[model samples]
Target: FHAIMNLFLLPLWFLSGAMFPISGAAPVLQALVWVNPVSYAVSGLRHGLHGFAETPAVLAGPAVCLVVTGGFALLTLAVAVWQVRRPFFQT
Candidate 1:
């Protein structure tokens, strides 16, 4: 389970711009960072901590990041609720 999750989570973390700013990354990587919810979360946190004016370069403005993060949260919440409502076993 640990290895399986790492396979998914590790890439997500790396592609999330956690190690470096997305601005200096390649176009493909920048696209990946833009789609990564974790990236938005991290950007939102950074903006909050450093204030919008002083944060490191990010894919989107603080408002955009906040909206995307909130949307991702709502989407995941909806998926979780949907899954919970489904039968656990099809037997």
Candidate 2:
């Protein structure tokens, strides 16, 4: 079910306006496009193509992305290490 849901999501995302612009649609319907997770891909594509990009928390560029991603990875690693050592402390 997980894999099936993932597969369906990819195409559904495409139809939800991630593939192209959907102008003249009703306001409510357009709102759906904006809310769709896949719509982010479209926003990114549009921004990249137009040479005007705005990623979330934009004041931070590649450096920030790198730092954030690395920080999260390190946090995960630390948690994993603690879990591994937890049995030793149970006594």
Candidate 3:
């Protein structure tokens, strides 16, 4: 689980534009960033802290981030419950 989380989070950090602006990334990478939910959260943080000198077209604003965050939370909760209820090994 730790290894899987590391594998997932490493790309998430990079592709979410935490290390650099998404605009400066390669076209393929930019496409990936747009699809990543973390990118919207980063955009919201940047906007709240620095203001959007040039907002990315993909980000609708903080409201979108809130909605996405809530959705992810609910999804995670549901998955956790499902996992807990399921048998570790089927007969």
Candidate 4:
């Protein structure tokens, strides 16, 4: 639920600029574009739409994002599964 809004709706909201960033907005909001998956999605879509990669091949942003997200997901899932499999108290 939270991820859905963060990953999808926020980008749409930002693009519409309905409540933010016409020329002046919070620096934090501007910086969020770098980490929010929506930003990556938008940038990637723009590249595809324009028939060229948005960033140079040397760019590591996407790779870093993928690894970080992947690692977090895996780590959380592992912890959850471990907790399920190993109770705090056993008989």
Candidate 5:
């Protein structure tokens, strides 16, 4: 399970611009970064820490990033609550 999750999520972390900026990335990668929730979170943090003056070129500005990150958080919270409300199998 851990390995499978890593296989799925490692790319997400990599594409979140935690290691490098996405500006010079390939178009496909840039597209992926734009859609990634983690990317918005990273962008929000970057904006908070450095503002736009020193940060790399982000696809969305700080306001947009804030909205996207908050929306993503709410969405994930809703999904988690929904999942918890569903019936579960027991051994």
Candidate 6:
């Protein structure tokens, strides 16, 4: 499970622009970064901490994060409940 989670998160770290500026990446990668939830969070943090200029997207980041986080929480909770309810004999 840990390995699987890392596999998923590792791509996100790069796609989220955490490893470098999004502008420095390829156009295709830049588009992906624009849609990545982590990008908004990072952009928001950067703006907040370093006085980076807030683009319209960056200005919306906090609200987007709240909604995205809530959705993920609900999805995780539903999955956990479903797993717990599964029959033990089911392989």
Worst 10 residues of 3 by lDDT: 51-60
Which digits, one per residue and each the tens of the lDDT, describe model 4 over residues 1-91?
Answer: 6996488676655743234433364666656644554444444444455554454321135556456546656876998799789978988
Q: Global lDDT for candidate 2? A: 0.56
Q: Give the Cα lDDT of each candidate.
A: 0.84, 0.56, 0.78, 0.53, 0.84, 0.70
Q: What TM-scores do the predictions have?
A: 0.81, 0.40, 0.79, 0.37, 0.80, 0.65
Worst 10 residues of 5 by lDDT: 51-60
What value of lDDT does candidate 6 attain over all alpha carbons? 0.70
**RMSD, model 5, all Cα superposed?**
2.6
Tens-place lDDT digits, model 6, residues 15-90: 8866877777799998988777667666656656655454433424556756764675687799989989999895
- Which candidate, 1 or 3, would have the higher TM-score against the true structure? 1
**How good is model 3 by TM-score?**
0.79
Query: lDDT tens digits, residues 1-91, model 5?
Result: 7998699689988999887778778999988998899898887887888864876556578999999989988998998899899889855
Q: Is candidate 3 or candidate 6 better by TM-score?
A: 3
Which stretch of 10 consecutive residues in model 2 shows the poorest summed lDDT? 56-65
- Model 1, range 1-91, lDDT digits (tens) per residue? 7998699789988998879888899999988888899898888778887774766666578899889999988998999899899999999
Residue 91 shift from truth in candidate 5, angstroms: 14
Please, what are the lDDT tens digits per residue for candidate 3 over residues 1-91? 9998799778987888878877788999989988787777777777787665775543557788778767866887999899999999999
For every model shown, the clashing-pair count is 0, 0, 0, 0, 0, 0
Candidate 2 lDDT over residue span 1-91, tens digit each: 7997689577657656645555655777677765554454445445455554554322224444345446655876998898788877555
Choose 2 or 4, whichever is better by TM-score.
Answer: 2
lDDT of 3: 0.78
- lDDT: which is higher, 2 or 5? 5
